[model samples]
Target: MTPTQIAALIVAGAFVLLVVLLAIPLVKLGRTLDEATVAIRKAHENTDPIFTGANSTLTHVNTQLERVDGITANAKTVSGNVSALSSLFTATLGGPLVKTAAFSYGVSKALRARRKRKEEPWGKHSRRKGGRK
Candidate 1:
C-alpha cells in the first residue's frame, strides 16, 4: 500500500474512536435526563394529595375562625350592656349611698364620744385635774 493511503486509514480510525468516546457520555446524559423527568413527575403526583389536604385544613380553620368571630361579637355586646348597667346603677344610687354612709359614720362617732364622756367618773375631775371636782 501507498504511504498516503495508510495515513488516511489511520485518521479515519482515530475519528471513529473519538466519536465513540463522545457518544458514551451523550447516551448517559440522556438517561440521566429521563430519570430527572420521572422524579419530577412522581413529586408532582405526591404533592397533589398534600395540597388537597392543606386546602381542607384551611377550610376547617376558616370555619372555626368564623365561629370565634361570632363569639367575639356576642362578648362585645355583653360587655357594652354590662357597662351601661353599671352606669345606670351609679347614676341612680351612687350619690344616695355615699350620703347615707357618711351620715351613719357621723352618728356612730357622736354616740361613741357621748358614751366615753359618760363613762368618766362623776366624783373624779376630768382631764383638767387629778383631784376631785
Candidate 2:
C-alpha cells in the first residue's frame, strides 16, 4: 500500500479504538441509570402505604385529643360547681354554727366556775380584773 494509504488506515483504526472505549463507558452508564430508576420506583411503592398509614394515625390521635379536651372542660365545670356549693354551704350555716358553739361554751364555763366556788370557798384562785372575790 502507498504510505499515504497506510497513514489513513492508521488514523481510521485509532478512531475506531477510541469509539469502542467511549462506547463501553456509555453502555455502563445506561445500565446504571436503569438500576437507579428501578430503585426509585421500588422506594416509591414502599413509602406510599407508609405515608397513608401515618396520615390515618395522626387523624385518630387528633380525635382522641379532642375527646380529652372535652373531658378536661367537663372536669373544670364540675370543679367550679363543687366550689360554688362549698361556698354556699359556708355562707348559709357557718356564722350561726360558730356563734352557737361559742354561746354553749360560755354557759358551760360559767356553770363549772360557780360549782367550783361552792365546793372550795376558801381556795386560792386567780382573780379577774373586776369580778366577785
Query: Which of the numbered candidates is closest to the native, going by highest lDDT?
Result: 2
TM-score to true structure, per model: 0.80, 0.64
Candidate 2 — which residues are off by over 4 angstroms? 1-7, 97-133
Assess each prediction's global lDDT (C-alpha) against the native.
0.91, 0.92
Tens-digit lDDT string for candidate 2 (1-133): 9999999999999999999999999999999999999999999999989999999999999999999999999999999999999898889988888899999999999999988977766656535445555
- Give the per-residue lDDT of model 1 (tens digit) for 1-133: 8999999999999999999999999999999999999999999999999999999999999999999999999999999999999999999999899899999999999997777767874434355455444
Per-candidate count of clashing residue pairs (backbone under 3 Å): 0, 0
Q: Global CA lDDT of candidate 1, please?
A: 0.91
Residue 32 local lDDT, model 1? 100
Top candidate by TM-score = 1
TM-score of 2: 0.64
